[model samples]
Target: MNTFLYDVKTKCPVCGREFTYTKVRMSHLKVLERRKDLYTKYDGIEPFFYDPIVCPNCGYAALSDVFNNISDEGKKEILSKITTNWTKRKFSGKRTPQKALESYLLSLYCSQLKNDKDIIFAKTCLRIAWIYNILNDSSNENRYLKISLDMYKKAYEGFEAYDGEIQLIYMIGELNKILGYRDEALKWFNKVINHPDRKNHSLIVNYAKDEWQSLKI
Candidate 1:
């Protein structure tokens, strides 16, 4: 059986003729429910029916189809994460996804401030960029990463510059990897492991480290 790559739209519903129509891959179709816990359970179309998105042409829809595509476990995981994040943002007063992530990171870094600081904001920015990355929106991805690097610069100010060097290097290495700068990423990873802060929490570059080790470069 072939997988339905796009939304199935029938031309003449009564005749059962396949339609030749342009396809639209809209944003992630989210089904919002009043009961967050119930939705996280991944039971079905929620307590009531809600359309996450609509077709521009024929207006055909099957909300259950979307839910059926992904497994119940996956649905529960995503719904739970959304609920948790939403709860965190409530206290942080960050309604937008962008602000919610930033606020969460800032709260995490609030106590770690030293005469010198860096990496916290960059990590936050990386997380923020993921919101767009998941949606295949390169425009926002690069934009947020650039902003993250700028934040890293600000984070590195007025303190022991070497404290978070490992994490800083890791973040730079990850960025380089994404930007297709393999050599530069390797160099950054090298700098991370050898840096004084290597023992503490770093940007967690295990994949790059493993790959680089295998390459024997």
Candidate 2:
């Protein structure tokens, strides 16, 4: 057993089964690099490998943050669509990159079944892209990045107000730049720089400025 990984007891919202899922210790995380799009490289275990909590019994899986927040109706959907075909499998031990990829894919599927927010799908897709980035699989990485970009755009256009709004705007630009959509990237970066609430988010504003300047060159 890896000392860096610890099990957390979780109750599946869809199937009412209690299970344990793996999580990485925060103390063990060492940031090696952070890309403009916020894909982080870590020195030791990839913490994200343990992010999508899976239920061994019923196949319910989602990012840890939203794992237990499914609605009653969502539970029914998962029961019908996922649990009915779920094979008993455990995801509690330390995970390999491939296993992590599988977990994220499962989370993506469950998110869609539950009609989760666009941001949730975007986040899952972005993580999938990051994993592919680590695997040096540019083709799959770009495919997921494009999906993430589309989802982010839908989320940005749909919501009036939400937490992380500023960051989301900035991510739109960053992802566009990453995907080589220079004109669209520049437009979003400008939106972030000139946003009325920029004063409250100096860090994001500064990042936007830096990316904007880089694009201009």
Candidate 3:
């Protein structure tokens, strides 16, 4: 059963009695045997370690809400709604994570002024690309990755956010590495590592360091 911690102090919903903040633990009474995977857009590729919230002052607080909490049935219903415009009108649309990601990106390529939504969609495409690459789906992975890189390049040219720039370059390096574009990967890795604006993110920095060192050997 999935469990989380919350601040249990508050004016009790049952009775209006305000208590001092106190931490409390709460668990799902029912264990939903759901597949634990990053199956949504905008959630990056990382292992989920729950660091639940606590508000001792409140005595009853919502914890572990960092992750979305939707039951399988609920998620299916939502997905059905999400895909109603483009695909079959069933809750169980058999839409894989990759498909959902691509569909989402496709929907974002509007002729009007693009904003954070378009960039976020590009990130989702990259995530799906990275997943497929890891799963050995080279063809689909490369396709999504190419699209992501194109969008990222556009963002890089258009905006000046350091974090976004670092990510854009880093992802290009990663995809090139997987695709055996060694020189291209090296170029991107060097650009990120040497760029004045790039932050030393754990994911990007560590990967760049390892690959840079390996290339030396």
**Candidate 1, run of 10 with poorest lDDT:** 36-45
**Candidates 2 and 3, the one with greater lDDT:** 2
Across 175-207, the per-residue lDDT of candidate 3 in tens digits comes to 667666788888888987887665656656667
Which candidate number has the best TM-score? 2
Better of 2 and 3 by TM-score: 2
lDDT of 2: 0.89
Q: On residues 28-134, what C-alpha lDDT tens digit does candidate 1 reach at each position?
A: 23444322111221222111112111222222221222312334454344334332343321211112344334433433232132111345445445555655664
1-217: candidate 2 lDDT, tens digit per residue: 7878887786778888788888788787789987778777778778878889999898889998888888888888888998888889878897888899999999999999889899989989999998998899999999999999999989999972336688899989999999999999999999999999999999889989999999999
Best-to-worst TM-score order: 2, 3, 1
TM-score of each: 0.39, 0.95, 0.47
TM-score of candidate 1 versus the correct structure, residues matched by position: 0.39
Candidate 1: RMSD to truth: 18.6
Q: List the residue pairs that clash in candidate 2.
A: none
By lDDT, the best candidate is 2
